[model samples]
Target: MDRGEQQLIDLVNAWAKYSEATPDADVAGFCLHYLTETAQPAVLNQHSPVASPDGLYDEKWVESLTGTANRSLTEIRPSSRLAALVGRLSKYGYFYSKKAMFPLNFKSIEEPVYLIVLAQMGTPKKSELIYEMMVEFASGIDVVNRLVGMGYIEEFPDENDRRSKRLRITEAGLTILQECFPVMNRVADVAYSSLTEGEKALLIQILDKLDRYHAEHYKLSKNAGFDEVYDRMVT
Candidate 1:
C-alpha cells in the first residue's frame, strides 16, 4: 500500500478508538482529535483557528501538509509552548475573575476559596487553615484578618492550643459564597466556552494529574533552594 493509504488507515484507527472511548461519540471533535493525536503539523493559521466551537479541521489543509508528519515536537518545543500558554491563560483567568467578583465584594478568587475551605473544616485552627491553603503564614494571616474585618469569617481562641486561634466561615461568608457560585461558574464558562465537552474532560484530567503531582512535593520542597527543588522534581 502507498503512504496515502497508510495515513488513511491510521486516521480510521484513531476514529475507532475515539468512538469507543466516548461512547456517546463526539463526532464534531474528531477533527481536532485527529490533528492532535497524529501531531500532523498542519498550520493552524489565522484562517484555521486552533480551537473552534464546532471542532472543525480542514481536510484540504491536512492534504496541504502531507509531507510534515516526519517532523517532531523538538521543532515545536511543546513544553515551553505549554508553559507559556499556561502563564498567559492564568492572566486571563485573573482578569475575568476580578471583574466578576467586584459586585460580590471579593477582592480576589482566594477569598471565596478560603471561605469554602474554612466552612468545610468546621472551625479549624488558624495554622491548619494556613497549611491547607499552602500560603505563607503572613499572607494567610492577612486574608484571615480581612475576612474577619469584613465579618465574613470569625476567629476565636483555640481551646486545644491557647496560643492559636480557630476559624469558621460566618453566615455572611456563606451567603456571599452562595451568590458567588453561579457568577464564578459563568466566569469559568467564558474561559472554557471554545472547548467541546470531550476536550473539557480531557483538560480536567490533565490539570488534575498535574495538581496531584505538585501537591505531593509542595511541602517537602517549600523551603528548598532552586537547584535542590529542580533536581528533586525533575528526576
Candidate 2:
C-alpha cells in the first residue's frame, strides 16, 4: 500500500526465496530468532522493568498484528502455506528491526530493567541473573533504581525470602506495550504486502520451524559464543 508496506513485502518475498534454498542455514534463523528472543531481554533492560517470563512481545499480539488469525501452517493447504509463512517471518523481522532502530533511552532507567521484567514474567517466577543481562548487554544498578523512581515498575516481595524483592509490570507499564502495538503493526504490514499469498505462507513455515528448533535447543545455545555469533549476524 504505502512505501513502508511495499518495502516489507519485498523483504519477506526475498527472505522466503532465500530460506527455501537453505532451510537448515542457521544464519537467517539466528538473525531472526535472536531478535525474537532478545527483544524481551532488551525491552526489560532498556525500557520498563517488566520481565516477560513467557517471552517478549506476546505471541497473540504478534499473530493478530501480522494477520495470522490463529491458524497453524499445517492447517493451510500447500498452495497458500508459503504466503502465510512469509507474512509471519517478515512480521517478526520488522518488529525487531524497528526496536533496534529506535532503542529506548536507558539514561534514566538502568539498561537491565527490561530483562528484570522479563525474568519476573517468565514462568515459575524465576529471577533473571544480573550476569545474564551483562552478557546480553552491559548494564548498571543506577539505571535500575532510576526506573523504580520513574514509576514504570514496583517492587514485589520475594516469596522465598522477605529480605529480597522482585520487579513486576504495573498498569502503566502495560500501557506502554499497548502504545507500541500500532507502530509494530504498521511495520509488519510494510514487510509482507508484496508477496503472493503462497510465498508468504512458506516464509511463515520456515520461521516457525526455526523458532521451534531454537526453543528445543535454547539451553545449550545460551552461551557467549552464540551471543557473539548472533550479535555479528544481526548487526
Candidate 3:
C-alpha cells in the first residue's frame, strides 16, 4: 500500500478507537475536525485529499475505510443539518417580515431599508449605509428615495461635504417602529420557539463565530487570481 493509503487507514483506525472510547463525542464532527486540523500541505495544494493522486487507489481501500469509519459511528461524513435549519428559518423570516410589514405598507425590500434607516438615525452617510447593508447602489438609492417620499426618513446635506446627504429617521418612522417592532420580534420568537433559552444562547454564540469568520476570512477580490488571492486572504 502507498503512504497515503497507509495514512488513511491509520487515521480511520485512530478515529474508530476514539469514537469507541467516547460514546457521546460527536463522531462525525470529530472526523471532520481531525481531517481539517491535520490536513497535509499536499492536500491543501491539491484541494481534495480523498481524490488526490496519493489518496485511496482503488474501490477496495475506499470500502475498507468506509467500513472502519462506520464501525464506531453510524454517520462518518459531515452533515447539513445546520444549513437545513437555517434554510427553514429563512423561510419563516421571509414570511413573518412580509406579514409584519403589511399593516405599515412596507414590502420585503422596504422593511429592511426602513430598519437600517431607523438604526442609523443620525450618523452614517447614505452611501456608507447602503454599502454596509451590502445592497446594489442603484437599488439602495431607490429605497432611500421611496422612504423619503413616504416622509418616514428625512435627509440633510452632509455638513462635511455639501454634495452628500445623510439620512435620519423622522418622528413618523419612530412611531411606526414603536408600533411594529414588538410584532416583528414575535416573529423571531416563533422561529426559536422550540429551542430552550440555553440552546438559543449557544446557537447565537456559534452563529456569531461563523458570521465573524465568514465576513473577515471569506471575502474575495474580483481582480486577484483565485488560488494565490484566496490562500493569502484566509491565511
TM-score, prediction 2: 0.40
Which lDDT tens digits does candidate 1 get at residues 127-220? 8898899888999999999899999999899887799888988898899889988988988888888899988987886788899999999888
- The backbone clash count of each candidate, in order, is 0, 42, 0
Worst 10 residues of 3 by lDDT: 69-78
| Cα-based lDDT for every prediction | 0.76, 0.52, 0.64
Which candidate achieves the best lDDT against the true structure?
A: 1
Expressed as tens digits, the lDDT of each residue in 1-235 for candidate 2 is 8999997896676566656767685555645553454344434335333333354335534554468535332223333545556576656665554563354433312233353444456422223534334434334344445555756556777888777766665666566555445655555566667788766876687678877876655555566596775664455
Off by over 4 Å in 3: 1-88, 109-113, 116-118, 215-229, 232-235
Pick by TM-score: 1 or 2, better one: 1
Give the best candidate by TM-score: 1
Give candidate 3's error at residue 135 in angstroms: 1.8
- Where does candidate 1 stray beyond 4 Å? 10-76
RMSD to native, candidate 1: 9.2
